[model samples]
Target: MNKHGLFQGGVAVVQPIDRGMTKMLDEQDDLYTVLLEGKLAGKKVQEHEIVESINETIRPYEDYQAYLDLAKNDAIQFIFSNTTEAGIAFDPQDTLTARPQNSYPGKLTALLYERFKLGKKGFQIIPCELINHNGNTLKEIVLKYAKLWDLGQNFVDWINTDNDFYATLVDRIVPGYPKDRATDLERAWGYHDKLIVKAEPFLIFVIEGNKKLEKLLPLKDAGLNVVVTDDMQPYRNRKVSLLNGPHTTMSPIARLAGIDTVGKVMQDKDFYKFINDEMYQEIIPTVALPKKELVAYAEGVKERFENPYVNHELSSIALNSISKFKARLLPTFKRYVATNHKLPQRITLALASYLKIYGGRADFEPQDTPEVLAAFKTLVQNDDYVTAALADAKLWGEDLTQYTGLVTLVKQDLQSLDQGGARQAVQQINQKGD
Candidate 1:
């Protein structure tokens, strides 16, 4: 049954096979499985690895010098990753077997080296890691690995000269198959395939890489929003600004506002207007993209937020608030600061909610500062206490404490909410911001 259960038993479970998948599957052990719990599982490949998922294949081949060659010969052009920002980390002592370098970047370097050695062709890697500059970051990691391994200047030059990495914006809400409909899905497929993941119908892979990759992949021609451009910055700017930028700023506020999911807050007429007009309309103009593109992009974001397949909770969005503020909110704030010569009011309030959340209240990691923690603890009790918060330039980078007007309003909002109540605070902010 194809989601609607309309076709029912007429549906089939077929692994979409192109030449790329077929080649790797032929060398079965060359792809999947790598001593999970002292045992190998999944279909065997030529490299003595079992055929698992895309990432699993990369795992066994990562550290090997011949990694790039295998990918070239197999016609495998892309590497899609969904690892966390932390996942791309590196450890100094990571060896061939035990640590396997223990990082997405290190692991990827090993794979690239394998492909490069085999046939000396570039792999068009499109990492879906949701990290800033996914391709460039991956490329940087590969270079780092080469240096660490003492693989010589020639390898580094080869990497610099012959690699094509695509920094991609992948926007499919792949919630890893419907657990709720386990029985029906299993019965319909007529077999058990744990790897059968579920993703929203809407899939977008926007790559800012080599222009030649578009002609090779042609995912856009396959009815996907797979755009290829040298400047992924504008697209990245649009999404980060319209979708993620608004979402991050509003999430803690929404949680404080008593709104749970993005869908719920969006349903409120006035709240939606505030977000659209204030957040998107007002802030989006500061970006270089045309207004129409911004609107269309934001409209798509609303649907992605409403995707029933994924439960992207507000609390989840609230993780690592400090770093997120730096990556997501800080950029927009800086732009606004550059223009207005002061902290943006809505953004300031958003930061205030974050400060309120950091009072030993949420599950985020606090930046290891006793003063910072102490201020958060104190400020949680007194929402209007912008003096201490603004004074801590280490956090805010400047004295926003003097922005008493904004602080007073945020304090009023913060004071009204019950202690540790993200929902109520969020609701109030949404209403006021509206």
Candidate 2:
């Protein structure tokens, strides 16, 4: 809205209380700089001083009650939020009388209820959280809060009838704050910008909605890669399987091989082929999207991973390996087994790497839930730790040992990893074609 003057309406940004940030925004007249880097920098304006004093329309609000007041008084048409994954949850302790509820859903419920009192039309809610069915999940929590608060059936009916919750998939690499070159950047821009953000050239915003919703928000008109569709499952699956699956599968193996960053992994021939084969052979085959589109996205993922400007650390990607494995790779693993009626060798090797890292066989410390870490400690003591770990339903949400030949394959790979290490194991697998 700020860049192209698409929406002339007032835009208020509500944030959790941050005194300094709010003060700065207020002082600067709601202006912030976005420094586009990488391939897309010079194609458009290199530095965007967005929302620069257009009637001072965009202002930052930290006070929850004040936000509610703005919602009550102003004709708020849309609400966009990126409150993180944990933001959309129900808080049992939240009440209607609380100044501001703790959870994002609770806060939204209060705002919706206030609107319900005034008989206003529901706002178009589009959440940018990186979760599956984020809009639906948020709406579910909001309804749960309404029930807990004992809000009447009429309010619930209004919520169901009026509100529009849009599930969205946002893909971008915003490596915020160029701290290393901040002084030079400030000197070049001839101004001090405390909230400048650095981002990559690529961006795709997929919203699960119809053409009517697409017309309402002309993000596509703004020359962005925004796809509004009735079904976003294919796009979602493509992102999870191709983009995230590679990260989860390669992180532990690369880290175990003493690789620190994704660019470094891509630089190594063995590691690059290992990841490329995993995606094309194992992961891409299981995704629901068209093969051409999936391959294109996978190629783009490779480019993004190889971006020298973005130092994506393997350890950062390795956080919560157990759950990341389940969410990112396990679906593709099961699908490959069901379809091929055999093991996906690369995915199996990835699983073994995960087990080795988490099962105390590697030098790395695995970060996961305390229960998961504790269970691994005991499972590793067993001679058949791979079998024991696979059989534990609590860890994988299912007894993975039940899959045909999965345990045996993973065990053999784990043994190979234990004896020869990750890089050697990767080379051996690459040399032995599937």
Candidate 3:
């Protein structure tokens, strides 16, 4: 087995210490743990068999106590998680009394208590769950567990003084298991493992909190985008809005353009420029980051979309469309309209694209079949259909009913889409933006 992630497949023979320190580190979906150390060092390993086939003379992690001892006594640490928005939640029934504890946080608190058993203060924990303020949320849960179990003031002080919890945002298109090329991929790694973290060549980690981590974890030392700041809001906004906002709004449109994946869409001159222009002019101006950083971010986004190894399907990114719009795009739309005194044309086209796509499939499934999508789903292909779609307040998260002109604009774009297609609608919106 080529223990060093080095390969002769035309890629440079560089043995990445952390393989970009990502572990694909995606959270949406994955095959298994990507080992960065031990004998398997550079090779991607089967997540399930990773602990079972141990060549080293070390015991496998047994429970929360194992984590506690490792982090405290042996000075090892890990951020264990299921990596879903639904997974990083507080469990009402989970308690210190329960063996292994039902909730991830409760189990984690027990471990923290064990690690601080010696009464010293120094551990930095960064959670990667997709929840809002993931690290803070976990800390809140840990405290709740402490109170629930009557763990005493000493433990609470230890928690406050001795450890640091960081909020971090991880970005990468880690689509798991290249089933189509699993055999060949496995052959390249010299293994029969199927649990691999398949991802794009792109990676970005924004760690906002605790400079103490710089002393140990070398994510920043490696020149990764690991920012240690007192505020995570700007980073969150930049990623959710500028980096993802345009893509979220444009994916369905991309799919409808007869494009299968983001990589291909990036190559399509019209779609590519449409997305780039939207992010720069419409979305970027509305975000909180500086113009310079935003521009650089947009440039890199084009490369991420162009990563050849990543098969980032347009439809896959289109899931949870309603939530995505509300969380990612809706606020930006409001900001753009509020500050600029008018609606952003390209974004509205993306929204209108959603309605048109929702009423019926264009090339991708509607983001969701929620009431908003459902209402459009009912409209007949009559002249009033586009107008009818914009009246739903439930989807827009506000009474967009008042924005009649905006509605008219969206309708016009939708009409153009019906008459010409995505390219023409995009062109019309660009002209309108100008």
Best by TM-score: 2
The worst-scoring run of ten residues by lDDT in candidate 2 lies at 53-62
Please provide, for model 1 over 200-276, each residue's C-alpha lDDT reduced to its tens digit, 9 standing for 90 to 100: 45545788867887666656655557788777787677766777777777777677666766667677664566566
lDDT of 2 by residue, 1-434 (tens): 44677865666766642333556676677777776655543243244445453222322233556757755755578888886544555679888787777667887888899999987788899998767888899889888988999998999998888989999988876656667777898898788887777767778899996567766887898788999988888788888888888888889888889998788999999999999999888888788778998888898889888776666677767766777787678889899999989988887888899988887778869876555789999998989888899999977879998998988889888888888989999999899867
Better of 1 and 3 by TM-score: 1
Off by over 4 Å in 2: 9-31, 40-70, 83-102, 315-324, 348-401, 405-420
Go through the candidates in order and give the clash count of each.
40, 0, 2
lDDT of 3 by residue, 217-238 (tens): 6656555556677777877888
- Any idea what lDDT model 3 has? 0.64
Q: Candidate 3, which segments miss by more than 4 Å at Cα?
A: 1-125, 129-132, 137-165, 215-225, 356-399, 402-404, 415-420, 431-433
Backbone clash total for model 2 is: 0
Cα RMSD, each candidate: 10.8, 4.7, 9.5
